[model samples]
Target: MRRPLAEQLPSTLVAALSSAFGVCLLETTGVLAQVLAADSVTGSSATVAALLQVVASVFIVIAVYVGSIVTANTFATIIAGRTRTIALYRLIGSSASDQRRAVAREGLVVGAVGSVIGAVLGTAITIGLVSVSVATGVVPSHPYSYLGPVIALPIVAVVLTTWLASWIGSRRVLQVSPMQATGGAVEKSLDEAAGGRGRSVVAVVFFALGGALLVLGMVIGLVSPLGVLVGVVGGLLSFTGLVLGSPLVMPVALRLTGRMFGRSAPARLAAENAVRYPERSSRTTIGLVIGVTLVTMFAVCVESYQVIITNAQRAQPEVYQGVDRTLTVTVVVFSVLMGFSALIAAVGMVNNLSMSVLQRTRELGLLRALGFTARQVRTMILAESAQLTVAAVLVGLVLGTFYGWAGAQSLLGSITGSPGIVLPAIPLALLAILAVAAAVLTLVASVAPSRRATRIAPVAALAVE
Candidate 1:
């Protein structure tokens, strides 16, 4: 039964699984690339090769972390909507453990299937890409030797990840009492779940700790690798603190945004809707927050490093000529990697928004029946999307830029003993552009769901579950 259901899972689940598979595939391929480089480089010392492998391994770990979080969140969203079904099983005399087992089994099945398919697809892609690169003289042709282990790693990693994600995701189903599930009260409103005052206190604690670490790191300066480590860790903690505290901040931000629209009905509706379910809205925006924050942080840090390097190059032009080239490569590589992570996160946002629209079908139908125009419905969605995007981008930019600056100060202090701050004008502009583009894209993603809502006859939509 679980196997059949797993086979018939929704497209969204399939998509999320595919993304997880892709991330694993990329990580495996990275390892392979490192191996190939190590083998082919004639003059490189063993230590250099070992360091390269370690770096690749570190990247793979990061990829796994990001991929797992996204997968878990996506799975949780899908499972949350199935409270009634789970309750039905309980009503039919299914034990809680039985239900849990069923869910775990289904997850295992999905993971096995998705991982196998992903491995095949990844192999094909890797072969094609490597073939093209070799043919174009961008890379030297080498006999691929690590193919077996390379393919095996992603398959194992992705399968385990998906299985874990699915199992943990289903735990929420267990939390819903049969009575609450049957009563259609399984899901709690954001305000209820967040417990405003308690959450605020927790948020404040996180902020204080993160801020203290960041300030301490700055004061200590980056005189050693440990200093760099402290700064990086501090920045990460601060970002986490911000995300955790977004719920406390969202209400005021939504109200301000609504006021900016000045009596527009759609804007007011959008803002109210967002505030009405703060938890849901925060979850939707959190993905964007993660993505934008990472991209901005990386960009700012790289640009700041460039500034410091440029200043140093002026004193020793010939010795630092290659430094600029290395910096350029570093920037490009990280930009692409972080950009991919951001794209995955954005997909999560789309899923969240789509689910939100779906859950509101009945409400939307009522609005339509009451003579609200389809255009107004669409406008409302766009307004909601724009508001979330604006809030996410603003928070992400501020946090990321500050972290980048802190990292730069650390690095500069380590290298030159004088920590001078330099703001990269062009990178800041680009960050703004990226933010706008993401907001526009999110608005565009809302179109399909909005159209579907408007197309359903009010009566028919109201009739739907």
Candidate 2:
């Protein structure tokens, strides 16, 4: 039977939606900037109607990407699990190359469909928002202005990038071997198999490039304020690479530290798990770490902007003289959203860990039978989870600190706007926050799986095969 296009359609539409969101962000931000630059209420109000168009475009794009990723993640995992199905097809005469083509074709369809949908929806939204704004008498419109470049280019680009992103996301699926798909061979350690030795070279190169960019950013600060944005983005990437390379050096450090823990069983086991597969564990936690770190980071960036805006208002207090309260409210709302994103990521990590533990029921049962008590096993797994979350937190703290200081200096220097001098209390507050959240998340993640481990009967566990 031929594969139906509907099975692949959702993901393609999703890719397009994600792209639309990115474009909408750019457009809405531009409109907001324009509003901020305006001197009078009437002038600023004129752009309010246009903002609806930008918002509509943004949501359309977001819907497409979210849809695509959901579809892609689902299918990718399914394909990963359905090696037997593919192998049966091969046994019945489907060639290996044909299998690859089918999977790749599905990916292409997902990307293309998502892209087209996102573009169409985004364009329609932009038009609708503008139309609605005019009808509400918020702003008088003669004809649609700024429609071509902002609306048109984004739609086309989003459609194309959707396909590209989906393809990239699914590329790893095509590399699975037939025997593994057929369950002829058990899966091996992806991290342990991938040696982390040469990461130093990559880190060193990134650090060097980042440092060079920092200097350039300082130079550009005098010419255009955007240089600060450049510096922030570059520094952020460099810091990510450095932290990633931490595991390359982790085993050496952890081995020396583990000697002290050798006297205790739980400690020893925990230490071993922490350092044993640094590459793999680190790779697993990278996405969550980035998400978590962004919490403190977004806060820091907001503080920088708050300072800049505060200073600007101070000099021309009349500009925001009446709207000071309004500005503060908006800033607080943005900060809260950033914090929520981090909490959501923490929950996701916990769910992901629980799912992994559940899937290894047979392996865990055998470990239990081989002299490991339920308590010890639970302790060991929790310890491993703790180690990863703690490392991620520490790394995030370091990155946040760098971002805060660099962003502060950049904004102040580039724009000649400083809100006030920093207090010693801020670092203490941030550090305390990092420690508490890390501990809480670790304990919470371990709780569910720990309970499940104790619930299994040894005979039933052993009989899983």
Q: How much does each candidate deviate from the true structure in C-alpha RMSD?
A: 4.8, 7.7
**TM-scores of all models?**
0.77, 0.63
Candidate 1: pairs in clash: none
lDDT of 1 by residue, 345-460 (tens): 56667777776676667678888999989999888888887788777777777767777666665545445323344554238576667766776677766878888888999998
What's the CA error at residue 196 for candidate 1, in Å? 6.5
lDDT digits (tens) for residues 1-465 of candidate 2: 245564343334335544444344344344333333442542354333443343344333433332333333334433433345566676677776776666666655655565556556545654555466557643244354333355554445544444444354334444555454445323323364346447667877777777677656655654444556666656755764555465564455445545543446766777776676564354434534554555666567566556666776677665445545335433543354355435434644554455445444555677787888888778776766666666666566666555554544454443333343332113356567767776787677676866685568766775542
Judging by lDDT against the true structure, name the best candidate: 1
- Report the Cα lDDT for residue 141, model 2: 49
Q: What is the lDDT of candidate 2?
A: 0.52
lDDT of 1: 0.62
